[model samples]
Target: MEIVMSGIAKAFGTNQVLRDVSITLKEGEVHALMGENGAGKSTLMNILTGIHKADAGTITIDGVERTFPNPREAELNGVAFIHQELNIWPNLTLLENLYLMRPKRNKFGMLDKKAMLAEAENTCRELGIELPLTTEAGLCSVGHQQMTEILRILMLDAKVVIMDEPTAALTERETATLFKMMRKMKARGVAIVYISHRMEEVFSECDKITVMRDGHTIITKPTSEISVDEVVRHMVGRSIDEFYPARTTTPGEVVMSVDNLKPEGFDNDISFSLRKGEILGVAGLMGAGRTEIMRAIFGVDKHNGGTVTVNGSVLNCKKPEDAIKAGIAFITENRKSEGLILDFSIGSNITLPNLDDICPSHVLDSGKLNSFADELSKKLGVKTQSIHEPASSLSGGNQQKVVIAKWVGKKPSIIIMDEPTRGIDIGAKRDIYDLMNELTNDGVSIIMVSSELPEVLGMSDRVMVIHEGRVAGILDRSDATPESIMTLATGGQ
Candidate 1:
């Protein structure tokens, strides 16, 4: 199948998202769509998937002009979109989930479980996947769940597959497996649209690359002809050095301390101290207990034994409210689910956690609330039509900013950021790093938990390596090399 989108344009109110963007995909080719957040990549895909109508554009598939008014129509037309959020029921088995999307029935019209199971088994075998068909889909790993989504699409006879960051949450082994699956699909003459922020994956897996910036198509070229730096320049309109902001704050006296912190999974004791005006990064691989330690400290998870001290005051935090009242804030890992209330307006979500700031008289002052939210939105450079708009209306990077804005408004003494820049664009990441630098410069200590090694190494005054839920070692900024951090993270001496 060959898909061509020409002169695509989109808008929301007065905000123009995409302007004259075009892309082409050939049969049996893996094409990468690269762009920063709010650059209209999602908007273009949404239009193609029939979620949104383009203000102006043309879509042609297999030499036939097509218009799909809805996602079902798009799917029926052999175009499938695998969103970042996998669509599957946790309560159903893998086979059941696959059948739910594309049901197979015998001549009598009764549900054909045997036929469905046989087809699923055959499909898995063909893909070289060792998935458990009878096991609950939710019980499987994220990589497996992703493969199940693909199988569901394939069962629908989809010819063009659009995957948005399919490997974002997968482990290295799982990523390799996903790559193998992509290769298999490509070999089957499938036209795959791969969108991701990981440069290495794009360079390795994609045959063609399309760069978009500020709602316009910057360039489209063979992946081999362009370099990573050149692609980044097109995406952000600048070089990579500007991606990570330089730290300007120096470490001071200890402001927060965790002694002998024991969570359920780790084999050894966890201890760390954060000095004032410091950014202490926690680095480790998946399942490294980095997030668990932060959760325990923030009172979301109970610790069997430990002492948490903030500014020489012992904290007996038994709940999130207790932690917040004690001058500690946490930006959780999953921002969409845990951080923001999608149905609420931008102003409402920002002030939900800091109501006291605007409701000192036991009632919210509407003017003050909106004013505060507006200021935060401006400070974070969140692009939106209005603060009254729902949080869901904003882009992923802007939504993340709202999450940070919520906690930063509280003026907490210490902030714990878990994967602060995950799933965001490069420009937003630079802004987040700058915000951290600003906060620490104001004596607001920070504890950052991240899987990205470069982020930990670049923004940290000191890095604490966690292995098996235990503190492997802490290295000063001068001594924290990627090799050393990995060694400690792997439980080396």
Candidate 2:
């Protein structure tokens, strides 16, 4: 099967998202759609998947012009989209979740439970998915849940499968398993549309690369013919001298300390410290309890045992309010859900955390709220028409800036950022790094938990490796290396 999209154009309220975009996918190949955030990649995919109508475009499958008015129509035409966020119910069994919408009916018109289970198990066996079918979908790891989604897509006999950030949250081992599955699908003549921000995955897994910049197709080339630098240049329209900004200050006195902190659901001890004017990076594999440690400190997750000391005072942070009152800010990993309320206005979300400051003396100040939000938005370079505009209206990078601005407004001495740059564009990432540098230079200590090794290494003054909820090791900037960090992450002493 072959699919071609030509002259795709889409616009939203005078904002042209896609212009003259074209792409082709062939059987037995993986095509990577590479672009920075807000580059119209999602818009193009939405048009192709029938989620949105294109202003002008032609979609031809096997030489026949086609249009998918709805997702079901696209599915009926042998196209399936596996979004980054898995849409599976945890309470149901894997088999149950897979066949939730499309259930096999026996001749008697009853649900075919036995056949469904058999097919699910056989599919798993064929795809090399080790997850069991009887287990609850929620109980399985993220990788297993993703595998189940893929299995469902295969059951539909989809000719084309679109995977968005498929391995973003997967561990190294899980990613390997996903790659193995992708290869099998490719061998079976399944055209895979793999969308990811990780450059390594594109080079390692994809066959052809399609670069899009500012709603236009930049170039399409074989992965073997392109270098990472070349791809990045095409995506950003320029070369980046430094992906991470250089540190300008030395660490001062310790600002925060976690001594033998023990959070729920883990047996190991956790300990770390952050100094004023320091960017202390926490590196670990997925499920290594890196986020868990931050949650414990920020009071998002209750710690079973241990004490938290902040700026020479020991305070028990039983709730987030306590942590906030104690001058600590936590920028959560899942920004859309936790960091900002999508339906809320930019000004509302920015001022949400610091409401107490703007609303003192038991009175609400509308003027103060808008002015404060406007100040923060401008300071963080948030691209928005009005502070009253919804946060969901902004691009990924700008929303992240809003998250940081919200915390900065509180005047916290220490900031905790989890997966700070996940799901954002390269340009936005550079802006965030610059902001971090500025914040650290102002004596605001930062504890950043990240899965990207380069980011941790480049931005950190000291790197702390977490292994299964325990502090594997902490190394000074000069002493930390990829090998050393990985060794510690894998439980090496």
Question: What TM-score, computed on C-alpha atoms, does each candidate reach?
Answer: 0.88, 0.92
lDDT, candidate 1, at 289: 78
Clashing residue pairs found in predicted model 1: none
With candidate 2 superimposed using the best TM-score fit, by how many Å does residue 6's alpha carbon deviate from the native?
Answer: 0.9
Q: 86-153 in candidate 1: lDDT tens per residue?
A: 78898999899888856888899988999988888997777666678899987765556777886688
Q: Which portions of model 1 show Cα errors greater than 4 Å? A: 88-99, 103-158, 238-240, 265-268, 490-493
Give one digit per residue, the lDDT tens place, for model 2 in 9-69.
9999889999999999999999999888888887888888999999998999999998888
Q: Please report the candidate that would top lDDT against the real structure.
A: 2
When summed lDDT is taken over every stretch of 10 residues in candidate 2, the lowest stretch is 123-132
* RMSD of each candidate relative to the true structure: 3.3, 2.5
Most TM-score-accurate candidate:
2
Least well predicted 10-residue stretch by lDDT in candidate 1: 168-177
Which ranges in model 2 have alpha carbons more than 4 Å from their true place?
90-95, 104-151
Q: How displaced is residue 172 in candidate 1, in Å?
A: 2.8
